[model samples]
Target: MTETSTVLRTGRKFDQVLKGAREVFMADGFEGASVDDIAKAANVSKATLYSYFPDKRLLFREVVQTECGRMSEQILSMVDETQPAREVLTVAAQQLAAFLISRFAQQIFRICVAERDRFPELGRAFYEAGPRNGCKQLMDYLEKAIAKGELQIDDVELAAEQFSELCKAKLWMEVAFGVRTSVEQAEIDVVAHSAVDMFMARYGV
Candidate 1:
């Protein structure tokens, strides 16, 4: 095979393995799932799975991290420097809520909670790599808004974290427990509006 074709095939196999791992982790839980099952689901051998992910823990970590990164990227991409603070916040909140309501969010949260006792490091890694990084990004946006006089905030980091909590509260609980049957656009609008309203009440000049 040509070098480019070989690279593309390898990348496709890696994606297949990752998708398989997510399915196994979601269905069997982190500790209950085995590498062989994942390989079977991915139609790859154990050696191939191991080559792609050194261990199951690492595979699970990558799954969570990939989902979180996608969410963060979506939120970050929506930020417009020239837009009003409230508008930017509304957009960001909507993006965040949408992400928190996804199937991947539900599965990742389940894995984190289930594996906390057996693999505390996995839980910590999830928090640090996902929410913590997201909070930092929010803080950066808040700081810029404050500097621009678009918003007033004494504690940007604290405000950012609070904003996240406000945006995620209901949907997060629903996702974490698999309670919500669906999270509609109406729900997203309601949560985003409420979150933006509260945030503005505190920070608007």
Candidate 2:
């Protein structure tokens, strides 16, 4: 059987189907979303949909993974290994924090939490696609910085997680709960710089 990821790159029709499915999933969420709705939205027969994605759960997982993968690519692309530690990290933190608090990100997170018990792999895939990828990208930057004698971190992985969490701090929870609908660039800048400051305080040489 062809996997969603494999078919994802095969042709235009596959792209259309997944894009349509993504819209339906985002609008209705996991449990509320129906295969019929997805097929209609995709303008494909149910058999066609199922051929690409074995089930609704698999479709949802692929949709979430696709979004996460795109975001991770953009976020990781923004990190420049050759830049100074503070400069590189400050930019990285700002972009990461912005993405984390965006409405779309929050919705994806909520969906994953709602479906996690029924479908643990979705949650694991979400974690792997976003946070784990973030941690690895940050760790790579930190490792490069350490090699250049720019940082003094003993545990790169923990530092990567801490720095990522630090960037989110108070705002992620607020955005996720609808306590606020959006964040200002100024506030993002403040949080990013603050996170970088704290991170460097511990690890900067």
Candidate 3:
């Protein structure tokens, strides 16, 4: 076979493992999930799964990083210099808030916390992979906005963090604990606008 076919075959198997791992992890949570479970779900041999991911924790992290990477792309695409800061941030805030309370995000958070004692680095790695990645994107946008005189900010990092936290507002804690299960778009809009309001009060030009 050609090199291209070999590459495609390898990539296909790699994706199958990830899809299986994600389903198993989401269903069983990290601590309870095993390599055998994932391999069975993926329709691959245990040895094949091991070849792709030697460790379960590494597999879990890869699942999260892959998901977060997709989301980061969507969020970053919203940052348009042609639009005003308020317009751009309002949309970003809504999307960020929605994702924060999403089942996927909540499960990842729960898994990291539940297994933190055994694998403290997993929590930190997840935070860096998802939250820090998003924070950096927001920071980059803020920095560009400041350079263009669209906003005034003394600390871009703090502002980025604050904006995301503000977007979370009342929804994050409630959703994480099962006190709430769903959020309406109207509510998201309200929270996003409020977050933008507070952020602008501090940093708007």
Candidate 4:
């Protein structure tokens, strides 16, 4: 295979492994899941699974990171310089909420909460790879907006964090507590608009 093709194949295999790990972890929890089950779910041999991931814990960590990374990328891509600040912020928040409400996200949250005691490292990894990275990305975007005179903020980092918290507050709580059944797109839109309004009132130019 050409180098590009090889890279693509490797990425596809990794994605397959991540998807399998998500199913197994969600169904069996961290403690109950096995490497064999993940391999079966991915339709790959144990050797292939091991080649991609050294161990089950590592596989789970990768799964969390991949999900969080995907969400972060989506949110980042939604920012548009040509758009109004409020509109940009609203879209970003809505995208973030949609990501958090996804089945993969909910499953990752459950895994972290349930396995925290047993796998403290996994919990730390999740927080660092997911929330911390997400907050950093938001802060970077907000800082750029402020520098461009689109926003007026004394503390970009704090504002970014608050923006995320506001948008995610209810959905996150519901997901964490297993009370959220389905969040409609309309509800997401409302929350996103409200968050944008509140944020703009505080920092908009």
Best by lDDT: 3
Q: Scored by CA lDDT, what does every candidate get?
A: 0.81, 0.83, 0.86, 0.79
Q: Number of the top candidate by TM-score?
A: 3
Superposition error at 7 for model 3 (Å): 15
Q: Report how far off residue 101 is in candidate 3 (Å).
A: 0.3
lDDT of 3 by residue, 66-174 (tens): 8999889887776676799899998899899889988899999998999889888778878998999899988988998899898999989999999989988998888
Candidates 2 and 4 compared: the better one by TM-score is 2
Question: Could you tell me the TM-score of candidate 2?
Answer: 0.91
Question: Which regions of candidate 1 deviate over 4 angstroms?
Answer: 1-12
Compute the lDDT of residue 71 as modeled in candidate 2: 80
Worst 10 residues of 3 by lDDT: 1-10
Rank order (by TM-score, best first): 3, 2, 1, 4
176-199 per-residue lDDT for model 4 (tens digits): 677978888988888788888888
Cα deviation of 147, candidate 4, in Å: 1.2
Misplaced by over 4 Å in model 3 are: 1-10
Better candidate number, 1 or 2, judged by lDDT: 2
Put the candidates in lDDT order, highest first. Answer: 3, 2, 1, 4
